[model samples]
Every structure is written in C-alpha cells, then in structure tokens.
Target: MKENVFYGKGMGPVKKDYPDIYEAIVGLNDAVYTGKALDYKTQKLIALAIAASNSDDRAVKKQISSVVETFDTSKDEIMDVLRIVLLTSGMPPFVKAVNLLYEVID
Candidate 1:
C-alpha cells in the first residue's frame, strides 16, 4: 500500500498492484503540496476549491477535514472558497460543498 498519499479512496489497489505508479503519484503529491509562492494554506484552499468544483463529495470532505486539522481555518474562510465554487462551478457543487463543510466541521 501507499505510505504517502493517504487521502484518496482508490489508492489502495493501485498501491498494491502498481507500486511504481503509486510512487510516482506520491512524488507528484509532494511536489504539488510543497508550496512555492502561494503558501500551504492557500494551496490547500485551492485544492478544496478544485475538489468542490469537481463535485467530488469524498474529496471535498477529505479536503475540509484535512484543512481543519492542519490549519486554523475558519468557517468563513471555507465559505469564501465555496462562493467561488458557486460562481464558477454553479450551485450544485457549491451547495454540496457547503453541506459537506458542515458535516466535517460540526
């Protein structure tokens, strides 16, 4: 199994069956998450937005939980990102993210 990249739902089989690919994914995760100019929180917020925009419920929840545990993120901060999702990805994703945020936070 993958020692890194622990948030996804599909990595287990990939890790067991395709160790080389899993390592590459881990490398990519490290490179992407190691913020350059945006800083860690900003990068995570962007990831949250992307997850929300994609309407990925599991990813949205994971991102919210990770953000909450890893940073001092406020509900307003997450709502701020969701607002962008509302405008760009429409009401469905925005609403889903809002609900998931509540589920994760409360």
Candidate 2:
C-alpha cells in the first residue's frame, strides 16, 4: 500500500513509535476507501474537494499528486471538484487549490 500523502511525515513517526496505532489507522483507511458505493477515483476527488475547502495547501497539493499518480485522474475531473470548492468554500481556498493543482500537475 502506498503511504497516504495526507498523513505526511507524521505517519512515519507514528508507525515507528506506535505500531499498533499505525495499523489501526491503516485499517480505518482500508475500510473507508473501499469502493462500495463510490469508486476510488470519486472518493479521491471528494477528498480533494475537502482538502481545498479546508484551505489546506499542502493537503490540496498532496491529494492532487496522489490521485493523479494513482488513478491517472484528469485535470477536468479535478477542475470539477475545485468548482465545488469554489461554491462552498469561496474564492480564497478555491484559488489556493487551483494554484496547488497546477503546481502538482503542470
């Protein structure tokens, strides 16, 4: 399994220092990412939107990178997600997310 970029550096420390906790987190991720109702790509897009909505620049960039690398997610798909962020989260976060998206993709 690929390391979740959202977890960043903290995950390595947690996994090294607290193996049980890391495994629990990994289990939770496995459960949550199951493609039952929505496919993994859709789930990732939703996650990207959430990251954008929160104005989390690092998360936005990492999510974009991970999604694109893992799923070959297209720019248009990401733009659609960013559209939602624009409506629900306003211009600032949306702009930040768009900028980060370009940084990662282009």
Q: Which candidate is the best by lDDT?
A: 1
lDDT of 2 by residue, 1-106 (tens): 3454435668888889999998898888888888889988888889889989999887888889889989888999999999999999899999999999889989
Clashing residue pairs in candidate 1 (N, C-alpha, C atoms within 3 angstroms): none
Q: What residue runs in model 2 are displaced by over 4 Å at the alpha carbon?
A: 1-6
lDDT of 1 by residue, 1-106 (tens): 1125477667899899999999998898888777678788998899899999999999999889888878869999999999999999999999999999999989
Worst 10 residues of 2 by lDDT: 1-10
Index of the highest-TM-score prediction:
2
Q: Give the lDDT of residue 44 in candidate 2.
A: 83
Residue 42, model 2: Cα distance from true site in angstroms: 0.4
lDDT of each: 0.88, 0.87
